[model samples]
Target: MKLPIYLDYNATTPVDKQVLDCLLPFFSENFGNAASRSHLYGWTAQEAVETARQQVADLIGAETKEIVFTSGATESNNLIIKGLFESSFPLKRHIITAETEHKAVLDVCKHLEKLGAEVSYLKPDNVGNITLEQVQKATREDTFLITVMFANNEIGTIQPIQAIGAWAKEKNICFHTDATQALGKISVNVNEMNIDALSLSGHKLYAPKGVGALYLKKKSPATHLMAQMDGGKHERGFRSGTLNVAGIVGLGKACELARNSLLFENQKLSVLRDKLEQGILQNVSNTQVNGNPTNRLPNLTNISFGGVDGENLLMSFRDIAVSSGSACTSASVEPSYVLKSIGLSDELAYASIRFSLGKYTTEAEIDFTIKYVREVVEALR
Candidate 1:
């Protein structure tokens, strides 16, 4: 077994061997600009990109043309929020989102607020869920979009996406979700969920970094947005940039694998995750699990240990990899905003740890982690 057992799959995942194999040829022998239409190389690259596009679309139940490639979820979020706001600035400026959304969504809303957009940030319930009623209350006559995350990255709380999507549809508003954490771990059908636009990142689901896709529904209230990037008008004029063929290929292959094995992988992960959570709780004193116990991602658990310093607890785990909060906000000394929003005090929030499993996780690793965590917490106290 590896010395340091990885329990930080929420931060990012290592590219799968199969995905890597599929993408490697694009970096060397098949290296070609996807835009160059006239040449054999360009045609080959374009064909590969199309194949990847189809793979991505298949995973999310979106049409081929609806998937727009981007650098990652951050860019996808930016393109959706900024593009929508830019296209309909003063007339429809209001957006409703949750307080526990990722920084990508929150920060974009903050930026838009400065540019005359009115955003209502709804607080979540104790279990890290923002109810459909909260969203309904936050909506306005001019509300053009309601963007929320499909799941909480820190606490592993799954939101009421279908409910929100249904409500948003009745209001003729664009409903978008940042499904970076939820995409491959759970089933996500855009049509069934009534989602108009959705963002996803490749690295979150065992694909190469620097590649992601935005799904913008074609009909049933087609989403119209201004292009964020100016050059060469790629991705159906929604995003403009030279395609990362290798990364895109990797992302596509990863999505295909995830689609094929999602149910089995999730079942395996859930069993291991529950064992880890139960073991730690049974062995360690004064520990409480965070997030919705039943409605969360099958592979993750967030727990707060009373009377242990967060930094000391994290530092003591020499042979285990875990996280206190979202990787994007780990540098900040402040306690997790997600935890705080869900009503955890500063001290409790600080001592919290997130253990996220993945396809590669094993029962042995879970056993090791449970024992290691108990020993560390006991020593710290």
Candidate 2:
């Protein structure tokens, strides 16, 4: 193991070479503002942007016009949350979001609260899942929005977006899902799911970083989004400023490949994940698996090693790439808000390890990772 075996796909994925191959020409010869209308370069870039938009739309059963490209998931999340408030909806002046939403969602809601909207933060079940009953009880007549993630990036649990979205639709509430982790890993049908809006990131799906999109439901005055950024009329005026043509093109290509081969990719990665999880539990002492094992993304596994510090474990695997579920706070170590919300103690949270598999993982890599992990944990003991 001369190089660290990269298993942090949930954090970010490597750009697919084939996607990069598609992106290379656009950087040099094809470079132009997709917004420009005067020249062949601009037309070429604009055409590519439209093609990529279609690719992204095809991934999640959205119309190309419904997809608004932005800087990344954070921007997408911000746009959706803020735009909902800025809209003319007769729904609940109250917003409902989960405690376990990405910081992007949580922080935005907090800010919105300061600006005078009431928000209810739903707590998930112990397995990191928000129940339909919980959501049903949370919705109010003025509930203008319901935002939840399609998957937990850290724990890898897939949320029931379709069920939640259906609940929102029945109440005429706008449903927005931060689907950054779900877009390429699993099937996302916005129509079938009854989702009003969804957010996604390019880096999460083997596309280059710094690019993402939000799916806006069409003709649905259910959502009236004011432009978040002021610039030339771009991204259908919801999001302004010129597009990052190269990154957007790369993102689109990545979406096309991921969409075409999703099932096969999930199956392959899940096998590697199961191997890693089984090996650790079989060989290690006092290790507890985190999250709902069955309802999680097939590419992820998080475990808590009793009596071992997470940083020590990560350092020991200086030869491996992984993350602790705990974040360091100024006064004390704060366990992952997601895990803590799901009821893990500080010690257990601090001891947690997350191994996320990805597009290029192999059985050989899993076997080697298992071997090294066992040795490291045993030595730590």
Highest-lDDT candidate: 1
Residue 92, model 1: Cα distance from true site in angstroms: 1.3
* Candidate 1 backbone overlaps, count: 0
Quote the lDDT for 23 in model 2.
93
Clashes of each: 0, 4
Per-residue lDDT of model 1, residues 1-381, tens digit only: 898999999999999999999999999999999999999999999999999999999999999999999999999999999999997779989999999999999999999999999999999989998999999998899998999999889999999999999999999999999999998899999999999999999999999989999999997433688888998988878888899999999999999999999999989989999999999999999999999998999999999999998778777888998898423344667788999999999888888999999999989999888888988888898
For all predicted structures, in order, the TM-scores are 0.98, 0.97
TM-score for predicted model 2 compared with the true structure: 0.97
Task: Give me the overall lDDT of model 1.
Answer: 0.92
Q: lDDT (CA) for every model shown?
A: 0.92, 0.88
- Candidate with best TM-score: 1
Off by over 4 Å in 1: 220-222, 326-332
Query: Per-residue CA lDDT of candidate 2, range 189-251, in tens?
Result: 999998998999999999999999999999753348777798887987888988999999999
Q: Where does model 2 exceed 4 Å of error?
A: 88-92, 328-333
Candidate 2 pairs with clashing backbones: 91-142, 92-142, 92-143, 93-142
